[model samples]
Target: MATDSIGNVELTDSTPTDATAFLIEPPRKRTKTTSGRRSRTNFEMLAWLFMRLSGIVLVFLVLGHLIIQLVLDGGVSKISFAFVAGRWASPFWQAWDLLMLWLAMLHGANGMRTVINDYAERPGTRFWLKVLLVAATVFTVLLGTLVIFTFDPNIS
Candidate 1:
């Protein structure tokens, strides 16, 4: 039992059933590392790094997009099909839009993966959710890329 700012509360200890849930000890006490699990943590580290870097880039890319589309020129009223066609005609704008699309989609997928990992309790549910997330992400990215690249200015 414990009493704090909230009120009386039961303090119970929790032990994880997963085999990988173990306290870190001194290097001398450490056991042999599993070969099968190599680089799993590395992937997580890369994902974390990607999130931070992508977020920074997204801020600039998104702000620039907004500034160009809504703040500069004739403002939102200037946005039209012809304007978009003219914009996409440039390779520079195509590359910028493509990079933004890929980054935003991947960033959102990674965030959702983190959420599914933290909140979902069942392993099966989590696996399926992640599978669905990947499928949706891939589908969206492919479709968006295709649309961006294949857009025809002459379509009436």
Candidate 2:
């Protein structure tokens, strides 16, 4: 084990596998205090954490939604235009669906963004892909919100 000037054992060369050579070089001492480039912020960390939290919340929201829409009362038979109108008339159900839509889309989109960032090696490609992802996410969320708020059952 080679110790730096600070006496910390370096693990850089400890791995002898041929594949390890292709990996990013171990950070050098200068990198620890480099000032030119901005360090990674907490956004990615928060995004990962959010994915986990949202996934858990989505489980409950989805299950409750499934139960109410597909398993309660008379199952799918109870779900008619009037049933939907009545449900949407209540602010509670509207809020529930809205939350579900927003959370699910954001969670799934962020997950895909992470995947793209990891796999897309080119900066330009990643930029355009993320732009498309953001546009789609925004469009879907906005369209769903509009439909939820503007649904008019009384219209003949």
Candidate 3:
């Protein structure tokens, strides 16, 4: 080993090594320099976990909703405003719908955010896309929640 001008000890390969070995670059040494940015949090890990859990719950919720609203009794034809009113009148159904609405909206918004983050090349474009996604999600969730809670069957 010989000391180079930069103080790095260079290893002289005296042996006739394979030609391919010379083509590979040495691994870079990492320096402990701070860029003044905060360290990464576990937000990505938590989001991944939430996506999985919410997906499982959404499957059950969506399946139950489809079965109850489409397969039971006389099918879609039987579903009217009165039918919806009656279903909403029950606390259990109300809770179920509320949960489904919230979960679906949140899950979809998160998925769209991920897509936008992955595909949007420009920082400004990504920001605006996420903002639009959040706005739509909030509006839909609020409107659905209000309708579910304040539904009245007496409207003639």
Candidate 4:
């Protein structure tokens, strides 16, 4: 029994004395469940790995892009339509842009999905939020990819 400062509140420490309570349980270790036992896939693990790898790749891609577009040569003033056309004309630049677009979009969308899953209390809310996130990501990726591949320097 104990008394608090607020008032004379009685307290009882009723700790469990069963064998189970006294037994030292080992920390939980995750084992890969057989497909027959569980249908859960390794999606979370893969998503975590993707986040790390994409972050590293994005550092290089985004830094290079910023340096080229905003810092090198005459800086932002030199980034004219013709400048963009010239850069996109090269296959290497095109591929770089495409990879950057895909990785950035996917990484951002995955991050949003994780946020939604963690914060959204309702299952329906989570599902719809993820759907919207995925739809927007897919749309943006497709549009960016189309523009990158189908860009015409001759457009007046």
Ten-residue stretch with the least lDDT total in model 2:
25-34
lDDT of 3 by residue, 43-148 (tens): 8788888899999999999999999889999888899998998888899999999999998898888899899988997779999999899999999999999999
Ten-residue segment with the worst summed lDDT in candidate 3?
27-36
Per-candidate TM equals 0.73, 0.71, 0.75, 0.74
Instruction: Please give the RMSD of candidate 1 to the true structure.
Output: 12.7
lDDT of 4 at 21: 56
lDDT of each: 0.90, 0.90, 0.87, 0.90
Residue 51, candidate 4: how far off, in angstroms? 0.7
What's the lDDT for residue 33 in model 2?
A: 52
Question: For residues 81-137, what per-residue lDDT tens digits would candidate 2 score against the true structure?
Answer: 999999999999999999999999999899889899889977799999999999999
Q: Give me the runs in candidate 2 sitting further than 4 Å from their true place.
A: 1-36
Off by over 4 Å in 1: 1-41
- TM-score of candidate 2 versus the correct structure, residues matched by position: 0.71
Would you give me the overall lDDT of model 1? 0.90
